[model samples]
Target chain A: MQLTSPDFPRNAAHALHDAALQRALGNLKAGFPGKRAAAVARLPEFEALRDLGRDLKNHIIEHLDYYLEQFEASVQRQGGQVHWARDAEEARAIILGICQRAGAKTVTKGKSMVSEEIGLNEHLAAHGIEPIETDLGEYIIQLRGEHPSHIIAPAIHVNLDQVSDAFHQHHQQYGKHERQTEPRALMNEAREILRDKFLRADVGITGANFCIAETGQTVIVTNEGNGDLTQLLPRVHIAITSIEKVVPTLEDAATFIRLLARSATGQEISVYTTFSAGGRRAEDLDGPEEFHVVLLDNGRSQMVGGEQQDMLRCIRCSACMNHCPVYGAIGGHAYGWVYPGPMGSVLTPQLVGIEHAAHLPNASTFCGRCESVCPVRIPLPRLLRNWRAREFERHLTPQGYRFGLRAWAWLTRRPALYCGLTRLGARLLRWLGGRSRRIRSLPLAGGWSAWRDMPAPQGRTFQALWAERQRAAGMEGKR
Target chain B: MTESTKRAPAAGRRVALLATCLVDLFRPTVAFAAVKLLEDAGCHVEVPVQTCCGQPAFNSGDRADARALAEQLIAAFEGCDYVVGPSGSCIGMLRHYPELFEAGSAWQVRAAALADKSYELLAFLVDVCGVEQVDAHYAGCVTYHDSCSGLRELGVKAQPRKLLASVSGLQLKEMEEAEICCGFGGTFCIKYPEISNRMVSDKCASIVASGADTLLAGDLGCLLNIAGKLKREGSTIRVRHVAEVLAGVADEPAIGDGE
Candidate 1:
């Protein structure tokens, strides 16, 4: 939530050296992409479905105000209320007001990145209301007093031992003090502890994967079903989501859900896909008595008709990060935000200004794996390049880098001068290497020569050799 | 000597070899191998007076300079029947030049025309020239590293492998995650060397696990990066450009190899 994106380089270096984090990141590389591939291979229409998802989101974003108004009327028709917050502070205040009105002592929350973006937990705790994370990953991270390193998998950077230790330390008061080595044991312990909190909580808040304008329904897909209990058992239920989540129809929600689960976790469908519309009906036996939806704009509306419009189509499935090698190496905390990876690289700059988050866009190899795997076909690499262009245009890039690029470009524009200089440089490098034919280190290239040897040039430029060959062939023809 | 019957085309086509800046400065044998392969494929090859492809600037966010270099490149090979390069990364940059210009502008039109005529060497050979195989041989097991640009940008996964199948005794052993980047993203290796080093280190481990005596790749930047790491770690695996191996001209000493 805080703007640590400026420290991305330092964070990446730290993550690279953190052995436990590296081990956790290894599982991400080995696990997600293959499952998604197999899942995609099983469906012949996966690409077509991605197209539909993209088109549907594009249609909604183009006419967002109309859809939001329609969604508001639908929610009001179902005895629910809609609140619009222009930014994070407004959204936080709106949620706090609802909790205060309900006289909530404690609140349970499903996994919501919007809440993290707004620093919601800290705000509630400051107001004397206890906020408990009901999602398993979110709960583990909350106990550790850390932010969600990853979007969907909040505690992905934490290893099994770390989780075991956290649970052992945190769950001792619940009379389950021994450290549980088995994952299922840990899950059962968490379930037991959270069940009590779920019953006592006066308010429940969750994030909606989709807000269906057709039926005033908010959809959430989770494997653990923690979201259902979080919203159902409380007296007051609130859903906090950004405006872009609103879709025109349930069929569009179905189309996106088909891609979201497979792209996120490689499941054809998550175990629990719950759809809730407003509060409990008069005929309903049990449900929340009050329902509210908070829509946060938070600079998203400005992205419409801009270069970053495609980024708004993101389903937050995180397929881009799952396939990204840089993320596979550094983990998500290095991104230093609620979102991470390629999507984060493009979106973080928009939310936090480029001056604070420039490194996010520059930290890619431009391998295009993110774009290749994106279900919505967001041209992620091109968007990153666009960010770079903006960074350059604003003169936000370092002076040294700009000068170096200008010098190189000036030299490259002149073929004869460029060829002559490179020929000399190549010879000099070869001479410096002597017979070893590899430079162990060089000035200004310590970064490259740090972990690898720089191979010496072949002592002659190709142009010179080609010119000699052409001359010899011309002489032979004359003879 | 016969695995299958395929022959080079009769000579007629004029092909310009845009030897990338790396080949022009660091490794000329790659350029020579490319010329040999093209000449053998019944094409009259000419070396254009070309500099860098402006990818470094384009990628570094210096579009003004990148466009200047792109315009220079467009003028250098204007009359050639086809523009081919040994490195897929540079060729991909050529293809992307059109995107750098404003739509419907004259420069954009020129960039688009140049992009249409450009091809990476292996793709040009197998796809355009219809050269089924090369009259070359290498008697060792070698694994190919699919550089990201060649593999993803140009769809060049099968072209080199398809041609390598015809080499007399070359056993193509596939490495795990071969398509992953070797982290020689032009300026990327220098700018983010630690992360780049880790990626290449992972790549080297995969290459070692394949039990191949030699490593090959389509892009010289990746080849150079991988070779540097292998040499630094004191591994015996040889590294060379795929064109050098396919042209039977790789005998000059592999990259980073000498007394």
Candidate 2:
């Protein structure tokens, strides 16, 4: 929630050196992409489905206000309420008011990135209301007193041993004393602890994967059924989501559901795809007594008509980060914000000011893998380049980098002069390289030579060699 | 006959070699090999007087400089039938030049014309020239590193491997994650050296795990970065440009290796 993006370089360096984090990241690289490729291979219309998903999101976002109003009316018609929040503060206040009105001592929660963005837990705690994370991954991170390093898998950066330790330390008071080593055992332990909280919580909160305008339904796709239980068992249920989560119809929501699980975890479908519409009906056997939807604008309205509009189509699949080399290396904590990876690089600048999160965009190699694999086909590299252009325009880029780029550009515009200077520099480098033909270190280029040798030039420029060859051919022809 | 008249034209193809700044300065053999490959494919090869492709500036968000360099490149190879380069990244930059100009402007038209005709070397060879297999040989187990631009932007993955299949005694051993970037993203390696170092280190480990004696890649930037890391780790695996290997001019010392 706080901006540590200014210290991204240091954060990334720290993550790189963290052996535990590196071990966690290794599993991420090994697990996600291969499964996604296999899942994609199984579906013949996967790419076509992606196109439909993109178009559907685009259509909805273009008429975001209409869709939002439609969704609100549908909720009201279903005996539910829609609350609008202009920003995070407003959203936090609305949720706190709801909790106070319900006389809630403890509120159970499903995994919600929006809540993290709004600092909801801290706000709730400050107001003397306890918020408990119900998702297994979110609960692990909550126990460790840490933020989610991943979008879908919050505790993905925490290895099994760490989770085992956290549960051991925290679950002692819950009458569970044995340390669990296996994943199944750990899950059962978390399930037992969370099941009690689920029954006792007065109000339950969950983040919606999509809010269907056709039926006023909030859809959440989770591997664990905690979201279902969290919203179902409580006296009151609140679905908190951003405005862009609205779709024109249930069919549009279905199209996105097909892609979300496949892109996020490489599943054809998540185990639990829960759709909750309104309060308990007269015919209903069991459900929440009251239902509410909190729509948080939080700087998204401005992004709708800008260069970053395409980002609103993101399904929070984590596919971009899954395939991102930088994110794979440094993990998400280094991003220093709620969202991380390629999507975060472009979106963070808009959500936080570019001045604060400038490094996020510049930290990429522009590898284009993220764009190639994104289900919505967001041109991530192009957007990053746009951010760089903005950063340059605002004079936010370092002065030394700006000067160096300017000098290089000036030299490149003049061919003969550039060639001559390069020739001399190549010769000098060759001489410095001597027999090894590589520079172990160089002035001002220590960043390159710090970890790897700088390959020296081959002593002669191509133009000079070509000219000599042409001269020799001319002489032979004259003879 | 005058010198110009003495030179025989090859089917009037008039191909111009935009030996990217990297090839021109760091490894001219790649350009030489590119010329040979083009000439062998029955196209007249010309070395146009060119500087950088302005990718450094273009990627850094300096459009004015990038456009100036693009204009210079367009002027240099205006009459050429086709423009080819040994590096996929540079040729990709050429293809992207048209986007830098305002639409419908004269310069925009010229940039589009240049972009339309530009091609990376191997793509031009197999795709345009219709060459089935190159008449070259290298006896070794070598893994090919697909540079990001050539592989992603130009669909260069199969082209090089297709060409390499014909080389006598050259067994192609596929490395794990061969398509992953070697972290030589022009300025990216310098800006984020620590992260870049980690990436290249991973790449080197993969290359070693593949048990290949040599490594080849289309772009010299990635080759140099990978070679530098290999050398730092005292790796015995040699690195060279794919163009050099395919042209049979790979007898020269490997990249980052002493003469």
Candidate 3:
């Protein structure tokens, strides 16, 4: 997908006015955040579990090479093949090679963020193989010829009407005539239509929530059960994920899974927590004939031991974005990448270069909400600040902002100049306020004054008045 | 700050008031109100020479300037027993000062010392100074907006409400999503005003829905943003710093009251 991250401000401005997207975003207020809060309240040991998860992920990352080799060997022992891709280019090529070897005409996929990160669907389609998304949200967005706006809920940005419209426009070839607007009706339609593709597809690609090293198993947590169908029904099963997802054992994976459901959708356990040990055994009645695991490093290898290594602990639960006010305001599409919100802000810069995605980090208010609710307790605000520091050091910050910060810093360090400027600034602002005591427009701060009236300074700095009070009362003399 | 206002409680412990650049320039009355509250709680308060906590530079990734400012603040208030400020944001910045210096260095030790002594006005009043209620009176019902830094960073949520509960003739109505950010994130408001506007607009809607005639908060940045948007939307909600109400100096005028 083409990246619009450089135009974040433009995308955000346009998103704010888009009535449909706003209405869809409004539902987020009533959903995940409240449920997650309730779920966390129900489990008293949830915080302790989070700490364990963090430590486990840290240990796994520190020994990533050892565990990955162990995992590959285990997968081979279990009659499954594992492929490592250093980056997106190699990852896509490896997946395409698997499909071509299987002579796949059609491939069905469950929701996978790594797939989106690698731009897999478009690549596969361009190579003359049809890729079908079985997840209902994915299918709606797919029908609209759009990428998933949100990670878990792919078509969350599209409302019921938009779904009906997309389905009405695209479902004509399926011999379905009526536009289904009811939630149940739309689900049934999507289910019926995707059922055919799931059965007919030669290869299935799904994302792994966890890849257990000891058991050589991959896990996918879902509510719709589409992942089970996508992997089981196809002749070839391919689980595509990033390298940081590997865990040392099933027990460690269990700990992460416990945190994931509660943080992601507030469920004790998702309706379907399916695990694949390997391809079907000789006597197995139903399972794929060939099983393959594609591990994509992308930028994760460099990130493993860096300052942003904390980000690798993310279980993709999206608790950060679910509770983020900034995400609540603009929705996911404005982030202008496959990932959006807090996790996206950090990961996007790592995957995509910081120059192209500079606005992502600068856009936050550093409110600390994302950090507070993050399941793995990634210090998102600090990471975002680190990016800002990186930007400033690299001369990537906007010239006006850099100069303003420099002037602010210089004046602040010198109390005398700072006080003088503040006193004069107070007087200027108060006079600008005139009798109303407010300025509707400011000289250079149009971003603030354009929409909100700046409350005028109360006239004269506090120190000046305090000095007068001190002299009159002989207060400092007594001190 | 130690000499004039009220009698000694902790044997007249010297507390330095940071005065935060915003409270100093935009709302000096908040500093005075803070002084009155501190003095009434049987403590001495000192207004030291200060400009800012370097939050703008720190948050904008200007670490060199941020560290310079932190070093200066540590030096300026070293003589005082405690450093208190009316802003959660500025005081919160001080709490993270140790991160600016090299680990285990002398400067880091001083930064940690400075941070340990720093407290937001409301938290210090209730938590440290043992202030239960105020002699202040305000007749109107008010809903408080929890500034994010104070709420999350310093745990200033219940202290303000607990104190506000005792004010004579005051009704503390709570707004839904009061803990959410009002979008006045220092430079964040200026850089992303439209998004900030949307956030503040939602905040205003919640404030309006609470049916309170007035709004109070600890930080001036949030107050200015909310008050600015409240006025632009033509709402009659009077806005004031929480310190003003607690000190009973609210009679001066609501923020932006003159014209």
Going through the candidates in the order shown, the clash numbers are: 0, 0, 2
**Per-residue lDDT of candidate 1, residues B165-205 (tens digit):** 99989999999999888888888888778889889999999
Comparing candidate 2 with candidate 3, which one achieves the higher DockQ? 3
> Against the hidden true structure, what lDDT does model 1 obtain?
0.91
TM-score for candidate 2: 0.98
| lDDT, candidate 3, A1-479, per-residue tens | 88999999999999999988888888987799889999999999999998898889889989999999999999999999999999999999999999999999999999999999999999999999999999998988888888877778878889888888988888889998898889999899888988898889999999999899999999999999999999999999999998999999988988988899899889998999999989999899999999999999998999977888999988999888878888888988899999999899999999999998999998888889888888888999999999999999999999988998898798889999889889999999999998889899889989987878888888978999988887867855565
Write the residue-wise lDDT of candidate 3 on B14-42 in tens digits: 89998899989999999999988888887
True contacts kept of each: 0.74, 0.73, 0.82
How do the predictions measure up, each by TM-score?
A: 0.98, 0.98, 0.98
Model 1 regions more than 4 Å off: B1-11
Could you arrange the candidates by DockQ from highest to lowest?
3, 2, 1
Q: Which stretches of candidate 3 lie over 4 Å from their true place?
A: A475-479, B1-10
What's the distance in Å from true for residue A329, model 3? 1.3
lDDT of 2: 0.91
Superposed on all Cα atoms, the candidates' RMSDs to the truth, in angstroms, are 2.7, 1.6, 1.6
